[model samples]
Target: MTGKQHLTGKVEALEGTKILCVGDVMLDRYVYGDVERISPEAPIPVLRVKDERSMLGGAGNVARNLAALGAHVAFASVVGADEVGEEIERMLGNVPHLQASLVVEPLRRSTVKTRFVAMGQQVLRADHETSAALTSAAQTEFIDRVRGLVPDVQVVVLSDYGKGVLTPEVCRAIIDVARAAGVPVVVDPKGRDYSLYRGASVVTPNRKELAEATGENASGDEAIVALARKLIGEAGIDAMIVTRSQEGMSVVMASGEVAHLPAEAREVFDVSGAGDTVISTLAASLAGGLSLVEAASLANTAAGIVVGKVGTAVVYLDELAAKLRENELSSIESKVATLQAAQDVAASWRARGLTVGFTNGCFDLLHPGHVALLAQSRALCDRLIVGLNSDASVSRLKGPTRPVQPDIARATVLASLASVDLVVIFEEDTPENLIRSLRPDVLIKGGDYTVETIVGADFVQSHGGKVAIIDLVPGFSTTKTVEKLSR
Candidate 1:
């Protein structure tokens, strides 16, 4: 199988894979606004507050990413006895398939990093945190909690942000317990001390962190691998995975095995929480029974996805699966076809006694609404054929500025969706011709359209086929999106 296919299968196997994540947890808050002028009181831009949001940060983010990948995560972390800490606990409680063990340290203060963003750019960042190591009593209790949870997990992840949660003692204790339990430990290391991570199965350090930790040149692939091996030998770890931003990732093992996987991200919108995504996916993949190399490869893919999104986002299983399918040439080419090909494919499905469904749209900027419509359409039949309006047709029907993406681009994207079995581009404003040609078993459309208003409803129903009107997801419209972008 191709690498994408292999990784896709590994992602599928991640369901119910138990993971124990122990480390620092914080709340990341973003304050978004518009900056129209300079502040009179200080040398800074004045941000007119508009909106704000928050999400789990640090190791809590790692656990969130693991949960998003369909893993059963046991998250253990320390939080201060404060309102922010309470909010963090409440957020963790809402994540599915996750069991949180948050130790409350009354004397310590919870960490909160707030960034002020204006016009899509961060202007300033303020932090409220305490970096002092946990009290001895609290550390002992934390380690004991982690140790008790290790035996049941298939993998252990130590997410260290240098936030004082993963102290030297805690790190060593958890690593030893995990090693004794035969559960591999994945460490997202912080600071220059590799000794704290001794006995780990793998340590993931970005280029900068690797250089700082080993005090070596991590500029090229050879230099990186050398530094990684040096650290592995020095730290008594089995292997090291170095994340080289745009250059990709390098896997160096003490067994003399090495592989440099290329970066998978197409666009870099935000690198926030990317490391969390990598380590979480790596641990989850390993727990799913993949080899270290296979796990790292999947982690690389997950990192690629998370960076393309805004904020400290987690990569969901469906998003990862869609990305993998989009990367496969055979999958894309087979799904996107001409009208004649779609007709033939529909006929073949019908010949095999399969019900074929048909749906049509400009699908300009495919959003959740479009995805929901297609998925619901697919569920009504064994096969789904999507009639895509060509760019020219879209411009003629909607306007010259319609279809933000070109015809081929739209068709390829539509075909990439697992719900869509075939995508056929049509030059006309309506799919009446295509539907008449294919004579699908079911005709599907969004609920906004009635049977009388639907282009092919009469023809399909007259030909003994049924029409389905699936509810549209509220508050999503490509036209509104385009207008907003224009504004």
Candidate 2:
């Protein structure tokens, strides 16, 4: 199979993939507001608080991402016996398909990072954390929990954030246990010493982390591979996957195999939990029986997707599937997506601060009027999604003889247009459900339909979106053209 096909198949097989994730868990909070003037007490800018949000951080993020990819994640971590730890436990419980084992350390403090932002820029960040290693009792209990869970999983991930969760002894214990069980261990390493993670299946380090760990120049592909090979040998690991921000990722093996994947070009937003996403995707792919190279490539694509979002976000399976299809298939073919995938694509666009536009029709026997409507709709937003009626729906709405083409054929024709970013085939007579799910920023239709007549106009307007009616092209009607041809 082609590489894309292989990766896509692996992604599809990710459902029910079992993985063990062990590392530090923290709470990430964001405080958003407006900065209108300087503070009266100091020269610093004042942030008028507007909104606040929180999510699981550190290894918890990895587990979250794994769950988002449909994996059955066994998450093992340590939390303090405090309110924040209790909150973390509550959040972990809410993550579907995840089994969390958290050891409560009475002497430790749960980590919490709060960032203050104004006008889309972060002004300050405050951290509340305890970096001390877990006490002996807590350590013993944690490792015992992880050991009990290792044999049941296909892969083990060690997410080390230097937050005292993955201590040297704990790392060695888990790695050895996993190795004994024939389950590969993937480590997101921290610190300069590679010896702590010896005998791991693979170690993933970013460009900076690789340089720091190896004490070598990892500036180019060749240098990175060299450093990775050296680290693999010294660290007693099978391979190393080095994540380069814009330069892409490099995978080097002790067996002298190497693959350098270029970065997927995407607008970079908050890169907070991108590493968590990469490791999560990697582990899930491995559990799904993908080769190391294929897993790295899939993880690379996933990293690209997560970085486009505004915060520490997990990449959904639909989003990854959509992006992979976009990468592997022809542009027109890629534009045809399932409703779930289209919804995810629309969400990704919105996360990148782009407005999404929606317009739908039978789109059979393509004509200038349809083209005009699509072009005008495209001009109204950053991305336009065309919801095409299925053959059954079209037959019901316009009679069996009305639609001259099948749904796929008509969708392909619409997708071939530059104005359409996505084409979703809806089985319903109208695109109301599709519109409601996608929740586009603007809803557009032909001038023949008024705002009151539009299917999703009220819903869109209720959500602070717009409704636009583009005038139809004169003398350009699909029914007239079909009649003329018949005559």
Candidate 3:
């Protein structure tokens, strides 16, 4: 079934699902700097540190994603009794309904992946960690704690980064406890052995891991499907999802049913912890009763969103809803603006007690469909905001030599329309982020969209908003107008 048909039931189930994530947790530290001078000893430029920040990594990132997706998430992981552990706690504290329990190992140094970025590019990365297996006593204590939480959760995720917390015994103990309690277990495995994850409900592996463990180079679509099936059988997992960067993912069910999901990413800025996003989303969806197919699809879309971010990040429920809305409007809405301005404009719409219906377009030339859609959009709400593409944004979406009119001219023409209440221009090719910022109460598109096709439909619908398809006016379009003019 399509995403929309399954969405209603799946989302309703999410509110009741509780998830527990336990595994290797790390702190991701970023040191931002500027390279103004070169070092005499080496060819590297000297970096003047400007800022330092830290976020949750590994299993902690999984827990963050689960919480952001509205699951009642409890994280159980080991942290060194140190400052990095304290900072990790502080970050996780900000998430609502998420609780973190730590087993501090005095002897173990907390895992920290610190990267130095200069002008948005990573200059170098430094790691502070230990990959040795936990002591037998520590492993038993961790298992007891996870067992205590297992009975209360509907699903469990074991995020093994090979950072020492997740040993074979720990994985087995988690799986046993979860199975005993009739709860689902999912794993993000590390190292070369697939046998460690035997009996998991699902195991997610990236292309490299899958290739390494299965001894099969699952590069093309057919090979991925084949490998997923083989691994599911060999590892005894109920299902397997192999994450293919840029290409999305392929899910293989225990019954050998293979489903392929395409990546929805328009741009990929950084893909530091996209796997965490996938596993987190899948666990929540499964706990909420989504089928393997439905859950995997949501995971695919969510991962696509996170990779566009700069570092390890979580996908907000509201952001997902906005992405769905934009997908719904792609055929109709055009033009784009900076995310900050888009948010400000969206806030303005919210305060007016008017449901600002938004739809964008290139509007290269004002045409009858544009006027009709704007009028119809205005009819749905007290006001209508037209998101236009700046000349640059348009060139990214449409080709160069396009936008027949500049952004300023297009804005002037759109502003002149009696139906258009406001106009905001965005710079990105897809208005995914812009739609997220504007978060219009009602998203208007042409009749061409289904609930699934609407980019921000999920975001809007999740927030009690509606998406409508307005009929296009006949004999309209910039392309047609251009054709006539050229003739």
Candidate 2 lDDT over 1-487, as tens digits, reads 6556656656887889999999999999988667889988999998887556788999999999999999999999999999999999999999999999999999899999999876556789999999899899999999899999998999999999999989999999999999999999999999999999999998999999999987778899889988898888887999999999998899899999999898885688778899999999999998998899989999999999888766678888977887877755687888898885676577667655578999999988998888989999999999999999999998899886878999999999999999999999999988899999898889999867889999989999986789999898898877778889989
lDDT (Cα, 0-100) at 80 in candidate 1: 94
TM-score of each: 0.70, 0.75, 0.68
**Model 3 clash number:** 28
What TM value does model 2 have?
Answer: 0.75
lDDT tens readout by residue for model 3, 1-487? 4444446435545654699999888899988667899999998889987556678899988988888788899899888789888777788788778988888787878889999987778889999988988887788888889889999998999998998888889888889888888999999989778788888999999999989988877799999888888888877888888999988888888886888888889877678899999999899889988888888887887887787666787786655555655545432233333354345344433433446687887888887777777887888988777878779987777676677898878887787777876778877776666677677778888866787897778887876678888878776777767778888
lDDT (C-alpha, whole model) for all candidates: 0.88, 0.89, 0.80
How far off is residue 242 in model 1, in Å? Answer: 0.3
Distance from true location, Cα of 176 in model 2, Å: 1.3
TM-score of 3: 0.68
* Backbone clash numbers for all candidates listed: 0, 0, 28
Off by over 4 Å in 3: 1-9, 329-487
